[model samples]
Target chain A: MENEFLPRRVRIEETKMMTSLEKWFKLDAQLDFKPGQFLEISVAGAGEAPISICSWNGVEICVRKVGRVSSALHQREKGDFIGIRGPYGNGFPMKEIEGEKLILVAGGLGMAPLRSVLQYVLKNRKKYGEVTFFYGIKCLEMMLFRDELLKLMEEENVNLHIAYEIEDEEIRNLKKRFPERFHKGMVTTLFEKVKVNTESFVVVCGPPIMYKFVLKKMEELGFYKERIYMTLERRMKCGTGKCRHCVVGIGSSSKLICRDGPVFSAIDAELIRELV
Target chain B: MKFLKLKKDQIEDFFDSIHSFGIVYAPVKSDGKISFRRAQNFSDVSLEYTRSQIPPKHVILPMEEPILKFREEEYFEVVDDENKVLLGVHHCDIIAFKMLDEVYLQPPKDIYYHERIKRTLIIGLSCIPDNYCFCKATNSFYTSDGFDIFLHDCGDFYFVRVATPRGLKVTENSKNLFEKVDEKDMELFVKAEKERFERVKGKNLWMIGDLIELRDENFWKIFSERCLNCGNCTLVCPTCQCFEVYDELEEDLKSGNRFRRWDSCMLRAHGLVADGHNFRERTEERLRNRLSCKLGEMRCVGCGRCTVYCPTGIDILEIVRALKE
Candidate 1:
């Protein structure tokens, strides 16, 4: 057979620098993908990087410019094409968590992948129960999808809670746009103010450091580890399972962030020591 | 099977004939030690050496390979290589190749690795074991499988056993250089090889099982301190398959090529993420990961290539023995 593992070139439809740490690129391809599965974007001459799909339906990648491949992604334009392979890894168990009260949390660029789930849940609104989006950023300027999110909150039956670590005045102007939803302080504080049943499913995505504190708050708020889900970021080289660059957990039993999961339940990720 | 009485003088002519078919690579003396390299002459190939400074892994899995090249938004293509024959590979190195094959050639096989592997022929040489050698621990001191042809040193002549149709073709074509197999000569050769292996093992070498037990022990701390985090071990290791892919841009900024290169877990950045969190931050953890992958994870295949090419002479077998305490 021919080289089946090779990536196909897909033109970039749109490109936006999400924050100082990340960039979002929407590819001109119909990639049938789940919320948590990721794609390996190849920058010709640079290398391939496994970036999580942030868009629900179309192929879009939210990449943090951390390493060589990511930095190259930021340099490309809307018309430029890059090699695209895979919608790999186990996505969030959307089918299983349907109809349960959902608490979605996004921290900084972590919102990129979690946004996929948010969009999915929003599209199929009546299929699930109450949906609460608790998005956290270092400041208002770092917030991604600010305009889209404002529009999302305006829709009926959606409870959106946006927070920043900086002073309240920084986000005061945004109050006019999202008067009822905007809140101050850390994202975890929303757990105290919000009320939900024990059957609620909480999804969290952020830096590795954010996990411990967020998980602690979830536990205090009567959310078990199994009820909470999170995504992990690692140095992935080959999106295919060959390179073994992204294997985590103890004993180095490979959990390919590219193939196994970018999103895992809090308890399911407990064995993974380095993931936040 | 054949016990051919070709003098050492005719070895160059054999290599010359093999070179006509394809490029032949073998261990050649470099600096003070031997390393696998393209062979220009038979005199440079060292079959008597214990082990080379580098495994023959690079012949298949190159240190730097271009997965694909792209020029702006116009064109993109991948580069494929030609066929070659690798000669004088040790049993340990061959076993390492097998381990690599199991991983890369598994379900959803890697096209890049498969392309190079398909065009290559493996010729294994049975060498007398040395103090540093511990292939027997992994049950790969001598391999009758995984090779197209197996060669054993029988005094003045070389005993060749063809294991594949390709190997049989090469032998049949060189009929003038080989003699028919004699039962008496085969028995004597096997007996001599067994005695040689036993003599090598009698020297107080480390046991493989002891190393497996020490994987969780405190012995890692001592070894970790000595490691400069240079990644030399992973670079020299034949079975270390970890890699990183990145894009390199030209001055125009509109075009670039994506390439994947060898990466090592021993490096500080191997486990680091974009947000500045390093999974294996401690030297002890990185060192332990490398050892465990070599001993426990890769133990079933029995490829001792890692032990053979360690620059610091960090015998993993010895480390495991120390851990057993």
Candidate 2:
């Protein structure tokens, strides 16, 4: 009999600017959640927006200043209190991918959710096979969790590949310093440089347009449709299924994205064409 | 279930007595539109109507409702506890009400909706279909549940089928207001039901095979061009439950109310995400999504309100018939 719309207050313990548009916040609450699950962040007068949980241990979320609620979040200081409800949606299938090779593909802001899975995978490194990380951004400035991605480059059994669209003097210098790890093009460009395992479980997250190209490249590289998992983003008003705004698929196959998924298999995404 | 008969002349007394239980909301003709309104007396109620422009759903899920009130760091829930009696609801709308219950009353139930629905009583009235009605095609012309009491017109009396304890309470309190149904009364009830069943020969637009499979571009193009996206169809739909939640602040900006307003998927803003990406950018895509969602879940009760209320005359049954062809 709990009210599903009610949000509990959580004070911000810390805040960091990841980019001009994306800001990171660490709350003073500990939430037990899976990787791809998102939080419905509430700013009283501004409204609510869904933010992806970017950290593994505590309540941390990445907010991009795109609309009203997120812009309000950007104006708040470290100690300001905000309302939060749910670590909703079916997150990544962490248990299913155990002992399988993980190829994490993140585009721009998509790194937030993938970061949660990456940290979980690295902590239990011996359980999994190899970890391949491919991150693509518009430029070096837009790269989220830059220091973390750099540190991940040195982790054992993990191969990190990065691609940036713009190649300025700074990007050129960085590319020269790390020739084998950096490439200049779309994230799909990194696929050709690496020796992909046909059996690897590929997890992708990114903008709407990026999915089509990335999935096509994965198909070309001989990855099974069922093995490729991607978390999708949709306009969700309520985290629960009652609000039909986040519905995907058609007819009997129709499923609420907020309840059934934020992460879905490539096969489901194929069947529900709206997901990609 | 119990069968009782109330004389046609006794309806006014029954209506007045039910006020003791709760506020009575029934069909009323006002400003050239027949809609549900609070009945102060039986004279204000209209029994002869095809359908209300806006459904009685607003009795439970209002067009605009406040779920929470926030002041600084504290938040409180705004729950309505008033008891209500929604009477004269058609069979199709009763089925539509059950569909709304299935969504809101499922796991992780909506407390606001639960509170309103629990406090309200529903009374179903048998209605003969007009040209706009296709409830028979949707299998919603006849309903055995989702109503406390059902009244079937039988000439001088109404054959009352009491399906719930709340319904029985009204008859019990009224004493001699309702009489026991005899064999002749049963025959009249059967004849009345038959007349209603035969009257619903509107359109046999029963949904064909998977509508998602019928995603023919040319077929959608002809209809999408005519769609104004005014969202009148969704507003009048009994089963369209999509909503948008937002907060409105006072002038001081210290306090605000979090409100959920009825929203339509036909609007562009419904599917637009944060990063300026709209999943349903074009009118064709929105139209397809709406039709497919309706067919997929069997959400369309075929009340034909959407067709009647639409400014562009985009008949849904016509589209369904074309798909069948």
Candidate 3:
């Protein structure tokens, strides 16, 4: 039997500074993974952290300088080899909602996972219907994949809605380019601008606080509970269910976020009272 | 499965016979606490102890161990394979082993735990309840499996029940020391089990599942207020398997060992995530989570380790009874 704890070595092909805190890494490994699945990125002496795979074809992860593992990751550049135990967790239900309209909701660093989903949709463009992407970030500085989002704006049939908390020069310049798409408000505010079809499958990935407000907005907009899928985050050790740190719910209903899900529907995530 | 007998005088020889399997660790009393310790001699093993303060989970999963050793780009898996014999493990603890197996030996198996558990042999000992024990109420009083051999204490003799091939081998190898069970010996063995059942007095926690649904904040706050969050209960718990991984560097910063250490959910850092977000910030919230787990999926074996080990006098049995009320 293979040791699940053993991490495979992957060298960094390239690295980019996305924000003051977040750094993007392009690995020399092509992992077989779905949209929302994550990798347990280990930095030897610095330890491990669950980083979401941002690229579909190759292994690309965005690391936010939040804790030890990520901080150590930021220090390392291209040519550095790190150990990775991953592509774990139930990723986005891409096949399930293949033919349906997709409402992609992402906040801050949550875009990393959604980018994988969007990339898959963009690849198999003929297999999907209308695609709507709603991205929310603090400002231009914190925004990840800004160039890609801009490129996505020009794509036929795909609508990009960008929400910024602060309205600065860059935001004004972006708004001047696409007045209808760019808006000055929170992620929930973007919902008011769009005509949300109840039939559309909504995939929301964001901070813990974003869920309550976003779910409420989606509910008010008449989105079905079954169709609204969201990826969650927790302090994970073993991506396997052995470590009870990332567990959600209580008793028999308890689920290991690492094993059972990082992606759970709004209805299923309801078991976690603090979550949805 | 077959029943045999070993007289009290032949225990030393019996212990000696089992030595070929591996090192035998049995209960021993030290500093007014009972815990499993390696027996160099038969006399070192304590046969009269009701329960060990700590469960024998370390036999499978150690408190701390190195998983990997890294030097620059090269990483090597740290392997520790030691054949072990755990003697005098109570039925409650044996059941706890089964629970650990469910998590570790399932699909995406934890290789470390799987390797350790496979090499280790279990020799269960029947135990009667003390004031701290409620294994009977939790339906873990009797365990017919999860062990190679089980010994029922029958005063002058031990009524041995062999459940595995290796267990039968031990009996076969030490056939001279064993004797055929007579009617009186069987009677005494049955009586011992009856005594265990009668002495096991506590609330039936199996039906207390609804207690987790109790939204009374004050009820949980009462316990949380007294809780030091020292995480002593999790350390002593047979089934609490939460852990955190870190790295210990050698003098040369290029090389280090990635170690996994036992972590407790009671600590504030357990739930604290990056960006200073604590999902379970309040004491009552963490208390509810721990109790809900004990009441829910990770059912307490009712060994009463938490009740006895808690610095403050917080009795889980009393809490269960109160929840029932």
lDDT digits (tens) for residues B1-325 of candidate 3: 8899999899889898888988778888889888898887887788778778888997778899998899875678886788789999999999999988888888898888888888888999988578888887677889999999999888888999999998888789889999898898889999989988888775566656556655577888877899998989888999888899999889988898989989988999888878788878888888778887786664678898998889997888777777777
In the range B1-325, model 1's lDDT, one tens digit per residue, is 4234444556667677777556788889989887888887888888777667777889888888766666754435474677778888877788888889988887678777887777777888877666666566666677777777777777766677778777777766676876766786678678768876784553233443335433553667777766678787788777889977665777787676667689998988888876687878988888776765676464332334455555566666667667666
Model 3: fnat (fraction of native contacts): 0.69
- Looking at candidate 3 chain A, the ten consecutive residues that score lowest on lDDT are A267-276
lDDT of each: 0.74, 0.87, 0.86
Candidate 3 deviant stretches above 4 angstroms:
none
Candidate 2 ranges with C-alpha deviation above 4 Å: B202-209
> Please, what is the TM-score per model?
0.88, 0.98, 0.98
lDDT of 3 at A80: 92
**Winner by DockQ:** 2
Clash pairs, candidate 3, are A251-B296, A251-B297
Local lDDT at B47 for model 1: 77
Clashes of each: 17, 1, 2
lDDT of 2 by residue, A93-126 (tens): 9888998998999998999999888878877788
Candidate 1 C-alpha RMSD relative to the actual structure: 3.6
Residues A48-81 of candidate 3: C-alpha lDDT, one tens digit per residue? 8888899886889998998888898899899999
Error of 3 at A46 (Å): 0.7
* Candidate 2 RMSD to the real structure: 1.3
